[model samples]
Target: MLRVGKKTAEDTQTPNNEIESSVTEWSEKVTSLLWLINADHILPQSYVPEGLENLPNSNVQVVEEAGRAFVRMTQNMDEPLYVANGYISATAQQNLYESKRQQYLEEGYTEERASMVIVDEYFPGGADEHQLGLTFDVCTDAALNLDVDFGLTPQGQWLEEHAWEYGFIFRGAEGAPKIYKPWQLRYVGETHAAIMEKLHLSLDEYLAYLEDKGTSYFSDVGAMHLDLIVYFTDSLSEIPLKIREVSGDNNGHYIVVCYR
Candidate 1:
């Protein structure tokens, strides 16, 4: 267990497997963040990828923006997701193709039954959110962007209320050329999620906040891995972000996000 005090990301640790209150549990992950890097990304060691096969044949749709290729997928199909999933190198595009194929098979799909377009010839990396496999895209209306009424679907609500639980954060919000996607998700894990949700942040605001706080919260050396739970498309949402305090700091300042 880990005990976290308010206002800092530091805590005292307990032996593993010791159960505690919600605060302590979040504190545990916060304090022991050094061990969570492996679970944060799909490369190296994939996180608890239990139901990847069941994720459906996430069509390989590509987009080219500013001279880069980005790989994306369409929406849900008429069937449930399968249970045949695995992870390989991060930069390797083949792993994505294979995962999609397996997912399609699990959905009772055959070659003739393969539906959806495959635009894998080129990819334009949209943003960090895509690299971490956190946020997927959707066609959004430009005029009403960021309007709460526009993003009220169950999935959209999940992105708003629970995406941070999976280490994903909201990015690229609040400006032209960079739109605010309530549907967009990034792998910021628990700390970012908790704080952002509590703060009700958009992508642009969140990044600016991180930089201003001088918190090496993302993609930087000596950065800390915030904790979070990943709920697959078919699974019950994990790690509720219902406002809670995480571990506190002693050696240095901590930016904690509480979760279970």
Candidate 2:
């Protein structure tokens, strides 16, 4: 885990100035579509998405771009897909998490054990991607109630294979810190999604890979002739002019997408 401790005067001074300078230099870059929101990195309780919209056939809301892509992706699927959850408010998340935790406690688990068990499937309040309005829990049948068995279903398999093509990714799975939630998808935009799928990297791994590579790391997605340039810097002055789109890893770096 990346531990950020409290900064002393000297530690804060230089880094603060550098960040200010970087922010000023990259003021035109805009907030990224690929922002990473997870348990370790959280959204504020007041953080409502700017483009929330109702998904076409569901009452659940998602950011506009992701909603559009989701609609298209679902339409192309051979089987029906159901939107089970999206855009949960911090309060609602808190309530649900607390309720579940209490249920676990009533079942005789200790407080710590209850929290651990609950978090294995649900994030507490602000520590979830659902608050970002760019995530959705989908299932082949709404009645299945989001069990691990969904991962074995045809709809889940289809999404695992094709969700990235529409800028979504299976956000959590086994072998990771979080529970395996095959039904949840987070939209990180098509360029990054495609690269992540091709390289077989999780979002966390992909972000770390970008940071290690530093600036000047670029790749081409062969068939589309798409150029991906990754920049990890305190400033964005070095970003290329032909940039088609920009996404932040939300961990102090930018990914620029361009076409050849």
Q: Rate the local accuracy (lDDT) of all candidates.
A: 0.35, 0.75
Give the lDDT of residue 202 in candidate 1: 55
RMSD of 2: 10.7
Q: What tens-digit string does per-residue lDDT give for candidate 2 at 60-175?
A: 99889899999999899889888888899988998998999999999999999997788776777788778888888887776737667777889888888888889888876622
lDDT tens per residue, model 1, 1-260: 67456744323443233333543445454421211111121233222222122123333221121001111111222212121112222444445545665677678877545433222221222212233333334323423233434356544544455445444454434212333444433334355455566567754465446446642323211124434322211111223343233322222334443333
Which portions of model 2 miss their true places by more than 4 Å?
Answer: 1-29, 174-178, 216-219, 258-260
Candidate 1 wrongly placed segments (more than 4 Å): 1-129, 138-150, 172-180, 215-260
The lDDT of model 1 is 0.35
* TM, every model: 0.32, 0.81
